[model samples]
Each structure stands twice: as structure tokens, then as C-alpha cells.
Target: MVAGKPFERWRVAGTRRRGLTVRLIGGIIPIVTLSARQNAGRLRQRQEWQFFATTFRARPGLAGLWWGIVVLRGVLPAGFAVAMGVLIGAIDDGAPLVAPLALTGVIFLGMQVLGPIHMALSRNMGDQTAAWLYDRLTDYCLEPAGLGHLENPGLAADQAAARDFDLGQSAPPLRLSMGFIADGIVSFVSGVACALVLFGYVWWAPPILAGCWLATHWLLRESGIWRDRNTDEVRRAQQDAEYHYRLAVDPAPAKEIRLFGLADWVLNRFVLRRRRLHELQFEATRLRERSVLLSLAVVLTGNLAVFGAIGRDLVGGGLALGAAVTFTQAAIGAVAIAFGGLNWSLDSAAAPVAAVLRLREPMATAGALPAPSGPSCPSGPTGSSGRPGSAGPLTAQTGSGAGELRLRGVTFGYPGTGTTVLRSLDLTVPAGSSVAIVGRNGAGKTTLAKLICRLYDPDEGSIEFDGVDIRRFEVEAWRAHISAVFQDYIRFEWPLRDNVAPTGAPDDMVLAALEAAGAHGLADLDTVLAKGYPGGIDLSGGQWQRVALARTLVAVRGGAGVVLLDEPTAQLDARGELEIFSRVLAETRGRTTVLISHRFSTVRMADLICVVEDGAVVEAGSHDQLMRANGRYRTMFDLQAQRFDEPQEVGGDVLA
Candidate 1:
């Protein structure tokens, strides 16, 4: 009882000392000063760590298994060293070897088993995390009701960083780098455990060894390249290099490159840009020789001092041979805390994650549309523009079909460009009538079409539909009533049926639309549109244009009451354009149609023709009336007709 009392008192005293030490550490932590840049860097790192933690929430079971393996892997090195020492001690005492051998074998087996499992888990986790980031980016990009955000050049850097994060151009892909991060974590933990094990031999030796090993991180900064290489100049170089690489690889540029004999030029440019990128990275991350030497000296001194003390104790019979062996292994394992590629992998992984998170608010704000203002505005589920939906709140409440569309005092400019594309433009299309807008390039013809389609809103005007402001209706609900084919239409590498009827329509409807667009019999409905697929064939530019027209026709058949065609027949010759435009008029006889075109043949077919000049409608009339008036339209039409009648030299330049 008396002995127990003294032991209890000793325990209490030790607890008090530990508590006091913890308090002292807490006080010191608050007093440490950090520069503004350092604080920001630490905050960013913390946010990145938080993002990484959230990835585990997606698959709890797998995450649990991964964490278990990590713990086992971390402790196995220390456990193996202790087991070896135990076996040696048993052998020297002529004790049973079976128990010690079994322990050592178990630890060794854990090391082997946990390694592959850890690798697989890291790979899967990294892939899932990358997928999550992509989905987030997609949602953020599409969440806005307007196209302003997409056109903003200021956000391009963030977009590029997020998109190229897992592409292995800047750094190792997350899948491969994830394994490195896991290994680093395990190594760090193992080192700390080894240092703790050394505590039993000598109180002061563990701190000296651990401090020296950790000091290498501050001394050399060998991973500075990965940490600081995401600067603007570096990013621009990467972009330039990637562009050159793409020129060599992409099929779209292959013909031009071969025709122009630009292979050597492209290769040289790529090499130079890559070399410049390397030079910049090296300039940012170069190590100082003096710091390296100092780090080496410090580490060597600490290791020698610890080792010399252990040897002296063992040789003088103050320590057992088994104890000496255990301490020696711990001391060596403590070197795992030294700086290595872990920082490089970690910084690279965190950069893209941080970039993606940083863009959320800016992208959202840029793409946001003003709220519907009038008391009559209807609210409903936001449907997609390309897909059909049941009659929504806007239509159900207002009971308005496609009616006379009017633009009053409209002005607009693309985001991030100081130049205004449209200034106080005004025009009107009577209900169930066709109007063709004609103008020289850069005269706001396409801009007017975009405004009518509600892809963008004017800066200072109101667009009215059926005597009510268009903004009084929900964006998606209003878009449901219109179909459009832009000049730059998407050529989806999907089957013909899917391309024509992207949201699924009746076969008869699809066929009828295809026939109307002059796209029938071009290919089988099941045939893929790209040559890369088996049993697929490529189409000419004119053929693809017809396919785009058929897609718009399908949307019309699904109850859309308005049509917008922007340079829709540019790929077709004059005769083809006339024939296609005839079919289009027949198919959309009663629908309100707006066309933007440079071809006078297609323009003359419209019921009303408006000539745009300097961002305004300078002339409006029928083709005969315009010719009689001898206005801008007349001069443009005469010039085109005269060109067609005249023949030029074989190698002479042609108007585009």
C-alpha cells in the first residue's frame, strides 16, 4: 500500500507537468508571427486539405478501408524493428523463437498486404474526386441563364487550370500523384513513431535527430518548382506549348499543316515554348548550395552524436545488444521525415482544387441574368432550351403563342470587350411572317439574332413578345417556343437519329424533318456521324449543315413556334441554298422566322428584307421595292449578281 501511494503521487506529478507543458505550447503558438503572404498560403493549404477530406464522404466504406490500411502501413516499420529486436533477444537467452518469429512474420505480412491495397484505394479515390470536380465545374458553368460568363476572357485562366488538372500536362495526374501523397503520409507517421521509440533509450537523442531531419524542408526548398510554377507567365507558356502540340495532333489542322508545309515550324515552336517553360520553372525553384551543405552538416552531426552515444553504452555493458539494435534501427528510420517529393505532389494536387473552388462565385455572378421585373412574370421549373416540356407556368398563365416580335432601342456588347456590337437598334417581325436581315460583316446582324433568341439581353432596351415584355416570362419557358441553327453548329459524333432527335422523338417525325431538310437518304439512321466509329462515315460541310437544319426542323415539329437561322446556308452553293430555303419556308410556313444571311438569293425569298448599316436598319422593303429605291440592298444585290455573271482567271482570288 505504501509503495502504491508513492507510485500514485509520481503519476499525478507527471500529469501536472504534461498539462503545464501543453499550456506553454499553446501560449507560444499564439505569439508566433506570420507575413501576409505566408498567412494566405497557409489558408489556401487548409482549404485544399478540407476539399480532400470531402472526397472521402463520397464512399465511406472504401475510405474507412483506406484509412485502416494507412494506419497499419505507418506503424509496420516501427513494429518490424521491435519484433526483430525481440527475436534477437530471445535467441541470445536461448528462449523460444516461435513467438517472436510469428510476430515478425505478421508485421512483415502486413507491410506487403497493405501496400497494394493502399495503391488501389488511392487511385480510385483520386479518380472519383476528379470526376466530382468536373461535375461541379459543369454545373457552375451552365447554371447561368445568359451566355455572358462563357464569353468573358478574364475567367479563362481558371477554366483552363480546372480543365487541365488531371490531363498530366502540368503535373502527374491525380491518380498517380495520390499514391505519392499516401506514401508521404505513411513515411511521416512512421518517422514520428520511430522517434518516439527512440525515447526509451535516450531522452535528448530523439529531439535532435527529428529536428535535424525536419530542418531539411526549410533548408533546401527543393519542391519550389511545383509550389510556385502556377504563375501567369508559366500558365501562358503551357497554353502556347499546348496549342502547338494540338496543331500537330488534331485532325482539323492536319490538312492545313500538310498543305502549308508548317510541320517544321510547329515542332520548333513547340520545343522553344517547352524550353522556356522549363527555364522559368528552374528560375523559380533553384536551390542554394550553401543551404544544401548546411542541411547535410546538421543531419550528419545529429546522427553521429546519437549513434556514438548508443555505441559507447553498448560496448561498456551499460546497454543490452538487443536494446542497441532496436535504437539503431529507430535512429535510421527517423530520416524518413526529411524533405522529398511529397511537397511537390501535394502542391500540384492542391493548386487545381483551389482554382476550381475560387471560380465558383465569379462564374455565377458573371452568368447571372436580371430577375424578371413585372408583376405578370411567371415562375416555374427551368426547362432546357433544346428539350421539350409540358406547357409551363409562363405559357399557361399568359396564354400567348409566338406573336409579333419587336426590338425597341436595343443596345448590346459582348462581355470583356469594350466595343459595342449593337447601338439602339430597332426592328419588328409581323406574326407568322418571314424576315431576312442583311448586312456587311460586323454590322450587328448576328447580334440581333442572339438578342431575339434570348441568349443575351440588350443593355438598354426591351424586347416584346405578343405585346408583353419578353423578360416577363421565365428564360427556359420562353426558349421552349423557339428553335435555332447558328452559324457554328455542333457536329455531334453520335448516331444520325440521336443527332436529329437529341431528346427522343417519334421515328416518323424524325424522318419527316430529315426529308424536309434534304438530309434524308444521306446515311442510315443508326450510322454514327464521325469516321472514327466503326461502320461510320464522315459528311461534307454542306451535308453537316443539312443535318443541323434537320435538328432544328425536329425541334419545330415538337411544337416550337419560332425559328432563327444565322448564316444557315453558308456552306451550300447558290442553287442548293435556294432549294433548301424553299423547303424551309414550306416547313415553317406559319411560324415566325428570322434569317441572317449574306446571300441575296436566300434574302430575296423572305417576305420582308431589312438592310442593316452601322448597327441600324437603314432600309426595309421587298426585293423589288428595294431595287426600285436603289438603296444599300440594291447595290449589294447588284454587286453579287454581277460577280456571278463574270468569270475570273483560274488562280484569281475569290470572295469568301
Candidate 2:
């Protein structure tokens, strides 16, 4: 759980042993078509090449090592067969047993020792490569560029597949591909040697082996298709299992489920999904059992034919017992190894290819967006020639003082929503000013604050810093001069110092800001803040709000020119709200401030008040001006001010 360790690394390592165990268990079980037909597609040649190049590039050393091991492994088995055959021929022909027996035992022992070493090394290397690939894919998915692409459901599903796919199968594919090439070479050499030896007796033995191999190859190709189809079904089942688990465990729905006594209903839904998975698995199992039985039948029949032919030769004194025994053992071992290598290669290639394709989809889409050029001022009145006024000094002068902020003709919408949240809103504040935005729910007050902070860009119009267009500057650079406490502000699981610091580290400036914001005594700055863990503490809503305010003050002290407070006192009592605001006003003199609130008392203190309704600025003026005019602002102010005496609920009407 340490930062920057990458989630994929932990998942990959944790699941690797389990995946291999599953494969081994499945290997022993009867062959079933566990793959789904939906997964099969015409392989793209370009993609194939890209997959090869990328895998090789990522693990060039491992690739070379694996290839060498495969070649050695393949050659050793054939060499052992030839040595055994020579030793048997000599013994049968009345040669001394000591020399031949010693040489034959040494060769067999060497092959046995080397086989395990090769398997161990290849497995270890494959695991390392899979881990590295998983990390790379995770990084690609998490990059800022991929954010927009994640909105696509298809892309999200593909990513989910990649993450959920078993990476333990990764090593098998790599090992099998190399193993196949090596086995093919060894098989060719052994076939030629056997043909030369058997031709003296009968030219038909080599041809029969070749025919059996061709027939098995065809069967294996068909089996590969079935396997891929079954894999898809299993993947779907896994997805369903995860969905059921989430529904059962998620916090948001727990209360509703408990209230309605729907525990059995949720459990039944989970059971139904799992039952479907079990049924699909049963079908796959049946199919695999049949396939294995058929394969074994073919293998046994082929061996019988060879044995029958050799028996005739022995009866005629054409071949010795030891020679026939050694040939049969070596040939059968080679055939079994070849089939295993091919099956592994064909079945294991899909997941890594799918992962790479999924990653590329997001990366390509992100790359196509138009790059934001150099900082260009966002279009606004401040940048226009009509407003040639210098609002105020750029930095803090001496004593605390309020600053000014002006917004002109701003319009904005959430991305892809096709509905404007704020439209043609204009407001202004003079130096040493504090303004509150007040309106009913969906009044666009929160939207206005976000636009000011540039968390998003305006669809039309602009926001200004002093007399300059804020958009013209680098986005981060402009944000550095603004401090905002959002309604949905996140509370990070870190020490209090980080929660209040200008950035992540503690500084003298952070301490000054925390004191000024009236939040310094909540807890020791060194105290770690996290929930549901040893030594972790949870803060109440009010205390968290205070900490949020402290975060903004830290930003302000670090040279933020503007401060946006969105419902800063929503969690506080009336007295606490007044005290916090009063301290903020006193300590943040000379700094421009925009406050968005439902409380009339909080808004009335502002030098300018703006009333937003239905995404437009319906009224704007000083608090006194608006109240005297008896406009939209006046009606809302009066309605809220009356709440204190009426003993009515606060925020009820405004929120409604």
C-alpha cells in the first residue's frame, strides 16, 4: 500500500502462485474447452509483430536465456536416447558392459539434472517479465493523458479484462514458444537418425511416426480454438463474481439493504450468478474430458502399431530387445514433449496480446487531442482594452486587508453533459472587498467558484486575476495564486501537517496560516490522520472543515492572490461559522475572497453580493444596494435573515 509501488505489482505477485497452481491442476484434469468463441478473431499481422517486438524489447536478456535453455533441454533428451541405444546394441552384440553402462548412466543423469534447472530458470524469468509488463500497463492506464479515454465504456471494459486476466499464464507462453522451436529441431534430427536405423529393418517405421504427428497436430489446432472459447467464458464468470461481491460489500447500499431486510435478496443474487458460472464450468469440464480421452486413445493406438512392428522384427532376429526398448521410450517422450509445447504456445498467447491492445486504445485516443498551446489569457473584460485599471498591489503590503476580484461574461458546462451550468455571469468587487454568492440549489454558485479556480475551463467568456486574463497564464501557474476550499474537498490519509501545509511538507508559513484560520488546536500537527487503522484518528465534520479552511489559508500565505470559500461553514454551528468567518476576514486582509453560502448573515458581510439563478447572474450589487432594491438578492436575504427569529430550519428552503 506504499505510495508509488504500483498496485499491479502487488496483484501480479500475489496471484502468480495461484495462477500456476490452477494451470497445473487443469493440465492434470481432462482437457476441456474453457475458452469462449467470442474471443476468437482473425489475428492482425501488424499486431502480431508489435506484440513480438514489445515482449522482446522488455525482456531481451530473459528471451535469450530461455531460448538457450530450450535448445539445450531439447537436445539433451535426444542425446540420451542415442546413448541408450548404442549401449544396448553393444551389450547385445557381446561387448563389455562396464564402459557402455557407465557412459549411458552419466548421460541420463546429466539430462535429469539439467531438465529441472532449465524449468526453474525459465519459470523465474517468465514471472519477472510478467510483473514488469503488469506494472507498465498499470502506469499507462493511470497517466493523466488516459483520463478522457476512461470515459468510454468499451475501453474501461477492456482495461478491466487486462487487469483481471491471469498473468501466471504469461511465462508458459514464452517458455512454450521457445520450447516448440527447440523441440522441432530436435524432432527433425531424431527422425532422420531413426529413419537411417530403421530403414535397414523396414522403411515404414519413420513414416508411421510422421503420420501420427501430422494427425495430432490437426487435432491440437482445433483444440486451441475450443480452449480460447472456454477462456472467455471463465473471464466473464470472474467479472460476474466480482460484481456480486461489490454489491454485497459496498457501504453506500448497506444501510438501504439493512433497513429493508434484503440480506437474503442480495445473497440469492450472488448465489444465482455463481451457479451460472458453475454450470459453464461443468460444460467446459465435460468437453475437456472427452478430448483427453480421444487424445489418449490415439496415442495408445500409435504406440501399439510401433510395438507390433518391432515385435515382428525381434522374432526375425533383425533388432535386439534393448535397442527396441530404447527407441520406443525416446520416441514417445519426444512426441509427448512436442505436443505439450504446442498446446502451451497456442493457449497462452491471447492475454498478453489483449493487454497490449487495451493499453494502446487509450494511449492512442489521448494522443489525438489538440494540445493546449502556450498560456493565452482566457477571454475576459480584465484583458480587454476597456478595463485599463490597475486593481491593487500584487502582493501583501503590511497589515491585513481585503483584495478585489472581478468576473465578466463567464459561461461554462460540464464536459460531455451538453448543458451549461453557468451562463453569461458577470460580477465585480473593488479593493478590500468580500463578496458572497447566494441562491437556491442549482444556482451555479459552486460552478462559478470552480471556473475561478480553473478546475475546468469556461465554454464561453473568461475569468481575470487582477486586470489580467487568468487563462492566458499557465493553468498550474495561475492556480498557484488561488486557494479554494471546495464543498467536496478530499481528506487525505496523512499527518495533520500535510493536511494543513501549503503543499505536502510542513513549513513556518503553514503554521501561521493554520493559526489565522482558527484551526491550529484541533490536533497536534504531527498526528497521523486516517480511519480504521491502529493509531489512526477520525475528525468530526466540523473539525475537518476547519482543517480544510486551514489548507486554504496555507495556500494564501504561500502567495495565493484569491481565495474561494464554497460552503466553508456548512458543517459548523451558527456561532462557530461566525467566528471562523470573522477570523478569516481579519487575518486575510489585502487578499481577494469569494464566499458561496446559503446563510444570509454570512453573505451580508460581503462588500458585494451576487445572486445566481438557473445558470445566470440574476442580480449583482453591494449587500446594502441589493437589499434596498428589493430584488432577487433582497428576497433571499430577507427570507434567510428571518430564520433566526422564526426557529425554522436553516438551508431547508435554499437547498430545496
Residue 242 of model 2 has an lDDT of: 57
In candidate 1, residue 494 scores what lDDT? 97
Instruction: Note the Cα lDDT for every prediction shown.
Output: 0.82, 0.63
What are the TM-scores, per candidate, against the unseen true structure?
A: 0.88, 0.66
What is the TM-score of candidate 2? Answer: 0.66
> Residues 1-656, candidate 1, lDDT per residue (tens digit)?
98899999999999999999999988777666445567867764674575566466556676677667777788788888888888888888899999999999999998898899899889998888788888878888899988877778777777777777789867778888778878987887888778888989989998999999988887877644454466877767777777788898899899989999999999999999878877765574678899889999999999999999999999999988878888888888888888432566776787777777777888888888777876656653255554644445534443434468888989888888887888888888887789999999999998888788788888888898776677777787778878899999999999999998888877888899899999889999999999899998999999999999998988877666678999998999989999999999998887889999999988899999999987888899889999999978889998988887876556677553
Q: How does model 1 fare in lDDT?
A: 0.82
Clashes of each: 0, 17
Question: After superposing candidate 2, which stretches have Cα over 4 Å from the reference?
Answer: 1-59, 74-79, 94-127, 134-138, 141-154, 162-307, 334-353, 360-471, 502-507, 531-534, 566-575, 585-587, 594-656
Instruction: Specify the highest-lDDT model's number.
Output: 1
